[model samples]
Target: MYSRSIMAVSSWNDNGQKQFVHDPYELYRSDFFPGLGWMLARSTWDELSPKWPKAYWDDWLRLKENHKGRQFIRPEVCRTYNFGELGSSLGQFFRQYLEPIKLNDVQVDWKSKDLSYLQEDKYAQHFANIVAKAKPVSGVNVLQETNNIDGDVRIKYRDQSDFEYIAGQFGIFQEWKDGVPRTAYKGVVVFRYPSTRARRVFLVGPESLKLLRITDS
Candidate 1:
């Protein structure tokens, strides 16, 4: 069993109550909170290492800098600050609003799991396994909003889903073209090896494209 703790603002009432969200920098969205019963239940309590908070803080700070109009915690949020100051402010905010949660005994996986696989052979084998067992991808679409008669307007597809993903599987359709899903392919050939293009940093779950190496050649 894995043990984890989340901070709640209030104590348990006569009504059944439980863990609360522990985000300090996040803007409260009333509309989003009411329907999170499914998501809250399924969240895995990872043995998320200590470095995660530092990594997250750096990313969060950078993201906040990109969008200055949305800072609700700091009054002089426009002013730039160091990591120490930001962290201090976060601690203060946490003390004000949150109470430490009590929980039943949980088994802790203290062994450090190294996620950074730097070896080339490991990566190659990983991709190979994914491609070997991947679901067949179908229904790719390419839409040209502006027509150019002079030359072929170069179009690129981002690594995203066209339709709702089912069981960690997605598709690049053949017949689903001209901005619509269709029944069958129109003279399309899929690939055996995964494309090196459209790369993204993967620190978590397996990428959808890695499994389905089927790209237009």
Candidate 2:
């Protein structure tokens, strides 16, 4: 089962992951699985049916499944969005985030694609390789240095506020949930760089790379 790509919603050409430019429809592993739309197998549903939580089912389901050593796949460009602004959170970040989320208009041929690489172990290994190869950039004005880099670059953020500020500089999604930025994998958020460039930008947390468990080879 997979999430229908809720967070980090944007057009295929606008805010998609730069690394997957040739296959923008490619799915990646996610920390939170579902919110707007998702799929569930009947067998899996039966296993979780009796133990459903009464509140925050989405969050609970994600944690529940995740605790079972399960991995969920989500699209870089979200397929669904949360428009109910009058909910419990009371329109918080509605304008700053939700309102700016662009619905994908392009049709993807999902049936024709080979998505086997999205399996838990394969995706984790592939994503880890990408993160390992990213050039770490550091400076008082780190964003400026990215302009001189030839390939993907990684910038570290100290905390939530720092992440928001960095995200603003790059104009990517700024929201975070459970210590993860939008579209993050192991606490690293990735997107195309400079708006005019196709190079990738990796916004990483202090210990994010370690979580990938990369080893010397």
Candidate 3:
């Protein structure tokens, strides 16, 4: 169960809207609340059970303070795939979004992995350095050079519109929740691109670096 707890928030679209997206195989930490196949400690359950929402418990959990300062391990590729094609939303996004998710097939020894770096304090610093060191690329034209780049790259987006435009180009998730994209860490979304290499692309918000101290003087 401990290893399974490391699973990503695969389904349960909160907005009830369709926005096609896809993910790759990688691991990162973020605040995206898990919808299904999640584990909870008995003690933690004791604390939250009293305040459980009568309806939309998942949306309630999306609130920051509810899971604030808590480190959640989510994978770039979802651990579980949702097969329900009919629901309240009437399968609106099923064909475009949910239907295409590639379930993780790699058997990883999660128990042996060092997850200490994923802790709040440690991950913040570690991720900040990664974003800072990433080669900066601007405009969709420049993105064509990624095939030749040697390391991780970062693309800065001025706003939600810009983010959607850039995300559309790379064919990744573009929806935002509370001003943050899915699988985001510190206002940046991480995903491996081109589907054939190990290099990752970081779609960073304008204020992300400042918030992460990557731009602090």
Candidate 4:
């Protein structure tokens, strides 16, 4: 549910509420923030892994122990990154990596920036320095996008036994890879669970859907 490991900055709203945004493309896509020029550097097992594992958590605990007094969440908006606390380097990142787009408000999880693509290059160490100073809490946000809305497309897991087709529910198509079948792409999920044949499910379809990924009480 989470995205790949990437360096990020904390951005804030006028009301003092804060959120972490790490995607350079998304930063440029919105109008409220600036962009920076930085490339992600990857050289770790967690970075390569599809999901964070126990080993990753173990390392994160060690990092937390090393910086016991350090505060990951800023008391106030960062001066250089305050628009809304969107950073000064936002423009640089936008120009370098994204198309002409405004850095807008977006969602991000900042719990794993300890060793993101921090090393930009050999000449400039400012970004690297900033990244080094930023110590995210030890954790991982499993969900990429949590917004749920009617008519929004999402991914859901289904089973082989049930073949019910509900209107308004966009059925996801999967193809076999290496003789194994799989979903074509990934996106947000309207249904809490998943289905084999995805359909554009309506909020009020005639039939009630029992999500597959539910926990039993």
lDDT of each: 0.22, 0.63, 0.65, 0.24
Which runs of model 4 end up more than 4 angstroms from their true locations?
1-158, 161-169, 176-181, 184-214
Task: Write down the worst ten-residue block by lDDT for model 3.
Answer: 12-21
Full candidate order by lDDT, most accurate first: 3, 2, 4, 1
Please provide TM-scores, in order, for all candidate models, with all chains considered together.
0.20, 0.71, 0.77, 0.16
RMSD (Å) per prediction? 20.2, 5.3, 4.9, 19.0
Candidate 3 residues lying further than 4 Å off, grouped into runs, are 1-26, 88-92, 140-150, 215-217
Please estimate how well model 4 matches the true structure, expressed as its whole-model Cα lDDT: 0.24
Error (Å) of candidate 1 at residue 214 is 8.0
Q: How high a TM-score does candidate 3 get?
A: 0.77
Give the per-residue lDDT of model 4 (tens digit) for 1-217: 1122222222321112122222222111011111122122254334434545565332342232322322111112212232322444367443432222224454335464343333222212432232223222111221222223222232233422221222112222121222111111111111221222221221211121221222211
List model 1 lDDT by residue over 47-76, tens digit each.
222223544332332232322211111110
lDDT of candidate 4 at residue 92, scale 0 to 100: 46
Model 1 compared with the native: what TM-score?
Answer: 0.20
Looking at model 1, which ten-residue stretch has the lowest summed lDDT?
Answer: 28-37
Higher lDDT: candidate 2 or 4? 2
Clashing pairs in 2: none
Better of 1 and 4 by TM-score: 1
